[model samples]
Target: MVIRLLREQEEETENRGKKGPFFLLIFIIVFLSIFAFVFPFFFGFLYILGFQKVMGCFPCTGQSKKRTESGVNNDIKRKDQKKPTSGSLKVNSNGNLQKEDAAKDDRLSLDARNSNLKDQISENEINGGTKFAFGELVEATDNFSSNCFLGEGGFGKVYKGHLKRLNQVVAIKQLDQNGVQGIREFVVEIVMLSQADHPNLVKLIGYCVEGDQRLLVYEYMPLGSLENHLHDLPPGQKPLDWNTRMRIAAGAAKGLEYLHDKMNPSVIYRDLKCSNILLGEGYHAKLSDFGLAKVGPIGDKTHVSTRVMGTYGYCAPDYAMTGQLTFKSDIYSFGVAFLELITGRKAIVQTKDRGELYLVAWARPMFKDRKNFSRMVDPLLQGQYPSRGLYQALAIAAMCVQEQPTMRPAISDVVMALNYLASQNYDPQTHLAQGPCGSPSRTGAKRDNDKAQIASDGSVRD
Candidate 1:
């Protein structure tokens, strides 16, 4: 009995020893789990203190203090430390914030060097003749970058610029120094624009005459020239609608009327073409590039004799043959532009109907036959114009392009006619059902309207 009790006690002691290791293992696991969970937060707190020390001091976090009080002075200090790479920021002339970096590039001075040229243009010639520095123009045009270049005109290269001082976008015409003719035009434009201010006329904002550089600045017209919309349209562009065309014509005529009748001396627009007529927003047209403008004959005189200069197909028959220029010559040119608008063809097109290369010649026969009036309308119009309106427009264009300048209607008369035409209503939904020639249930009309409709993005829709 004594031996059995001793064996049983030994067995119990062995089981207790085994159970001790298991409890120690469990204790170690619990300690490791607790340390793993709390270590992240403890390390984060230490790192934040080290960050505060590295950054000089801890930012105040108090509800009582104003929200901006802590960083107000700090931000200003940081800004002062950093040197500006462009120019100092300041409120511009138009109450807009912009960099005035042009001052750094103002290297040319107009004192004594071009005294003779300066004398030609007296201070009294114009009240406050805003003379822009060459540096300002250079900076505005980004040193006349190719991308900003608008086009090559009769004067020189034109660049679209943003004048920081004026806080406005403007078109800058820089003269070609090598061309002596450009110099005369530069002076003429500056003098003419200085005195003339009308809604239809392009406003010359300022001019730059530093050293050999001669630049004329004018307001930017976003829609570009009328010629651009008329010819060589880029892909995905719709043709100008008939109503828009009439409005442009009327607006342009008003500009000529302002120059011809409203001005005291009665200025004549010697150069009148689609290219010279610039369009603005909503296709509002304005006459531009007045380098070739000449004062009309005074009083009883009929014409002014000058060198023959203007676009080919647009010049009047009388002016082209003889150098005698009259207000009638401009009327003839306007007729050509009117014809182009009607035909949706250029005044001078290449290899187009061999003998009918000139739009005026091709349209002449069509005008003679009343039934052929529909043929003159632009196919791009998709037969959307009123028949009577089209006839009236064609009649006006025909009279303006008469072989005799005497037969041509005055610009005022033309304006009156176009104003009536522009007022005519057009219903595209109703017109689309008819043919291009206004004949009902015609397959040809439906086909043409369908093609134009597919290509049209509501540019012609009223």
Candidate 2:
């Protein structure tokens, strides 16, 4: 019984040892499982806390807040800056944006000014001229058709159009956007022509200003410009006779006289060339193209200071050199035009001979001698002009193109001389009766002697 009890005790001790190992294995397994699940979450929490602490310690958070605030302020500033006013913006932050804003402001200002001009036109402040619509002009010109094209000038292309509404034929000058003349010139022309009323001046019939299009309407000159008649005469066309030439010169001078003496403030005809002198039905000469006209200096001022602007050959030397424009400047240009009429040569001719290139330069030498006077007459005249008449005409042209502005004759004096010449009608029949050697007949000799006596008596000179 004692051996059996001892064996039971040993079995019980082995069982106890197995139970203790099993309990230990189960406890280790539970602890490992808990560590696997909880370790990741605890590490993540610690990592998040460290990341927050690092971000909080740096100044980037304040910088990010500032960037957001700056963006909002810029948005508010841009919205505030869009208001249009007379004063331009002064912004240092952005250059490209400032330029864009300035451009918008300029466009707005231009639109406002244009609106005012349109209102003035509607009120008839632009004289009795009509304000035409853009579409009307387009239709009248047949969409600026090539068939209706009359000519082109510095201003733009001209087209002959029949105004269906007014039952009037008109000459439409469409301004070139890329031309030297712009909105300022266009407005100046309208203002100048509207205030001027004279038979010797081309009438301003109407005008059109629409968006980018600018146009002027005038009474259609049937004979076109004097340049057409004088230079490049078409085939089988007759040259102007002595009387006709004198008449045109007198009329043009009278136009200048009216501008200088009649207008309240004298108007300076800055542009006076053959092309600007338009001929009417009876070859009546009238001054056109007042875009370059300027108001003369008032009171004691002797000359107007302006940028030198005119045809090169026709511009007065003093005006061209000094930019000091005077009424005598017009006189000088008139002298050039008269020279063109007398010689049928261009103001600046293109020829192989350098001596004959400039009409004034060529005529200056001829003016010094009486014998060269006949040579200066238009070869087209074929010696049909009278000797004394030629001398008197050259004298007038000579005094006109004097180097010194003070030496040039006034427009009134020029008018008197040209009027006398225009009245002394030249009979081509009487001219033809003279022999081939050009010996003066008794009547012709007597008439020449009388004219010489009269010219000597200061009728032509004064």
Best by TM-score: 2
lDDT tens per residue, model 1, 141-230: 999999899988768888999999989999999988674346656666766777888888888888886767888899999998998988
Report the Cα RMSD per candidate.
25.1, 17.6
Error of 2 at 79 (Å): 28
Native-vs-model 2 lDDT? Answer: 0.81
- lDDT for residue 100 in candidate 1, whole number 0-100: 52
Residue 15 shift from truth in candidate 1, angstroms: 99
TM-score of each: 0.68, 0.70
Q: What is the C-alpha RMSD, rounded to one decimal, of candidate 1?
A: 25.1
Candidate 1 wrong stretches, greater than 4 Å = 1-123, 126-128, 178-181, 352-356, 432-462
Question: Among these predicted structures, which one has the highest lDDT?
Answer: 2
Write down the RMSD of candidate 2 (Cα, Å).
Answer: 17.6
In model 1, the clashing pairs are none
